[model samples]
Target: MCKNIQLLNDDFLQDPYRDYAHVREECPVYWHEATAYWWLTRYDDVHFALRQPQFKSARLHALFDGIAPERLSRFTPLTRLLESRLLLTDGANHQRLRSLISTAFAPRHMDLIRPVIRQVIEDLLGEMQGRTSVEFIREFADPLPSRVITRILGLPAEHYEQFKSWTNDIYQFMGVSPVDRTTRAEIASTAAVEIERYLDRQLDDCAVGGGPNLLSVLKSASEAGERLSRTEIIANVVGLLNAGHETTTNLLGNGMYLLLTHAEQAQLLSHDRSLWPSFVEEVLRYESPVQIIARQLSEATEMHGVPLPAGANVLLFLGAANRDPRLFWQANQFDIQRQGARHLAFGFGPHFCIGAALARMITVEAFACLSKVWRSPRLAVTPRWRSYPVFRGLVDLQLHVTWQ
Candidate 1:
């Protein structure tokens, strides 16, 4: 049953949906021996697992033992920071941190940044004016959210390039294979240490002279007058800086790819302005920015009649769940008009991405601007896909643009 479910298969990497279809139909809750993680593909199973407390997010500790046990000391900085992130915490700790930081993403704050988002998009398009062929990821998709994130965090926009380098180092370790992880972890640890020290200074400055930024927002945030510690604040900020732009970058690149490939569907948005929201939703569902997320079972549990042992890791295939025919009609087809069950692209339950609203707004503004400015955009060459199983995005996309 699991013969066709090869996670590292070349054909599977190119188009995972085909393999996902096979697994979802044949073995919705199958074990992947190579990775030693239970694969959950059905929408209900994935959704249920995400909400249950037993399926804990705090699983990074296993990375140390599983990857390179002797290299534990080397990954100290990286592991320490990662383990503190709200994304990896649960229960009261996760709630407290999520609530405090969520103030920065409140609708009011996002509303204030709407014009800024549009301006960034316009400026990026402006830069594309002379070029007939534009590398969409590097020239536009990557920088848009980087600029936005820096603005939201009140950091100097000039530091974005450096920030990207640091975050990519960390991301590489998180996504790379075990064979390469030890080296990646060392690089990631160095990057983490540097970023932490940088954030420490920023936090000090914020404490002394408060500003209208995420740091300030977090500083003042309190739950029942209980506040975030200095370490907790810095750790979550690291998460923000990394997650804030990374997913948005994927959304833009992925959405653009879909739009370029599906000409008729792409044109539908221009004719009917109302389709913008659904367009974004469909983009998220069709080619989710975050393809897979993991949760370790805190204790033994049963899922879909399968008994999972304690401490078992389950890989929730959000991409597969989004395309599950059980919930969505003609699930594999890309149709903005079709809407029934909501997509788990941002995930479901407590760990649902808090920056989702900001991501959606950025995507809407971006495509809206591109529609008006690019005139007619089409793929210049076959886009290169990032091979990581956890995140779905293009490495680079070249677009043949008729600049308006």
Candidate 2:
């Protein structure tokens, strides 16, 4: 079957959900010849595709092998950093690392961080007080989690500035050719090395000092008397640091953007007050930051009536799937009253995001407080999108708001 296809455009960054909706209803699975990758639309299809463990995630190493092994050998250091953790691994290795990180994210520890979290949030708002115009992403969205992460990792707050820089650098790591990738890759790779080395020293101290933090908790993980290696701990921390904040930041930013645009939805939540959590969930379903996720096929499997051949790369268009007309009523509309928790934004099955609960809590608290206080909020300039195949959301958003 021939399906009409268009290459990913810059406009997708500004508003991708709309772009994905049209594609999902028209062409469920579209193949791009130039990119040599298949793109799948429809949320339920993506959900079922991800649920199959027979389809391997670890097969994504091809992303970096765009160059010959000899050429990429020089950039090995950078490659290693990006490919770290359970995020880059699959099967039992992924499970083991996830278990260690999950313990730190337990209900008990998240509650422990709540007060500090609120104080940090208030401190951010304090800085923005009386400013008639503010860039929400710069002032609020980007820094909140970086600040929280530094404290969670037991690093000093001053380092949050550098952490933000390093994370931003890492964010730019994808979608470059072998040469440019090599250049930017070094800076990001060097930062990853330094972070791991820094954590190594901290982990050693926690082992001896018995400090109560994420590092301390992971240090105590065991299986048949085998503790986590320094590399494994670093990988998990990198995974946590990357996962812990950035998506939440986008979720908050994207959700706020939606509410501001859809005044009725915004007003509904504003009036009810108790339904903020549902609103957050709907925002995630409506316009997820992670628009696409791809897994390489290790064996033959069928999805959406197409057989995924062995060694084929399959892309799950999460945004498309979320807006699937078959699964959601008025799927394209942003409805706060939408029921069910079947959205794949946080993923599903084994690779589901471990920080979902923490993310939801932050969004609820931040939006509730901002809604109550901020007098007027409007888009300062049109939010921009990244020029990459992945990560569909605003790269730079300027929202002007006033809080008297």
Candidate 3:
């Protein structure tokens, strides 16, 4: 094994697949010297790690462990909020939170939300008329999901920008390195407190003026006569807003980038409308939105002959596993027609993303609209990717398109 494998530099950030391929081949269960986290790259290792009981999901505390004492006090609200989030829970707690939240995301509920998503796509496209070159992330991708999520939560349209800003702050903290996390943690803490207060007020209103919004649905969610606590509702509502939009935004940008760069794949959609769903899956696998998910070992375990002790922090590379050549025939290629693309982009086991269906629906609708209107789409400039370690997305995708 090479000494000091530092994978967080600029080149790796811009394109990490080559590095992933190297690690998967050289050391599938390699430990990072700088970050002190075990990195898993191969498909089987990552898949097994995700499903094994030894690999626990409640690992967010490890992120805050390195902060200074005085500064850490400022993160109490953020810490509480993170711990309460459905993303970080396990076992019975995870089951309970998921059951309640799943009600709002049920198939019937998603059917009701579909028309709203389509309408939002239309409105966003309408605003982009008469422009030859457009920034996809800002003009369309970001707003489509953001608007839909805000509407789903029953928040006012004017608060959309605030919602986006706050979510970005929280995500920034999520994607930052532990050493540099103090500043991001402060920002995220403030965002957490502010959003908690905002949602608390919204929940109060939802209590009195009940509607078809998620707040109302969550407030009413019960299992075995136990309802979600106010803090639980707020924490998960914030999580939904973040997960609801961030990944979808990346999916659209990455999908469009692939289509624009590869004319053949883009043409497949023109011929077969049935390929839209598969297109979403291909984008997800080829360039996963959420690249890395962290976990802590609850007990001693061995992965690919590498001994991992209890409490070890491990980073599962979802993006890398999706492209693992062992599972995928032409893993790196973007083909919408690939069959049985068993990619773990949304993850596996009990902690799988709750908003997966909603994300797929939103991406399908947005891409369908883009395919119809953005004829002969071509990149206006080279695509620039965001520097977030956890999420993979374009900073901006400027494209030249002909309105059909």
- Using all chains and alpha carbons, the TM-scores for the candidates as numbered come to 0.94, 0.90, 0.94
Return model 1's CA RMSD, one decimal: 2.1
Model 1, position 40, has a per-residue lDDT of 95
Model 1: CA > 4 A from native: 67-71, 207-212, 222-226
lDDT tens readout by residue for model 1, 1-404: 65646677667777999889888888878988888889999999999998899999987786655665666877788887888798889999898888888888887677777877887887887877778889999999988998887777766677767876887788767763777767778899999999888877876676413333777677677323757776787778778868878789999999998887888897788799889889999999999989999889989998778899998988999999999999999998889898689999999899999888989999988888788777788788998778777888899998888877
lDDT of 3 by residue, 152-214 (tens): 777777888897798789877876466577888999999988988888887777752433488
User: Model 1 lDDT vs. the true structure?
Assistant: 0.83
Candidate 2 local lDDT, 340-381, one digit each (tens)? 657788888888988788788878888888886787688888
lDDT of every model, 2 decimals: 0.83, 0.72, 0.84
Q: List clash counts for every candidate, in order.
A: 0, 2, 0
Sort the candidates on lDDT, descending order. Answer: 3, 1, 2
Residue pair clashes in candidate 2: 42-321, 43-321
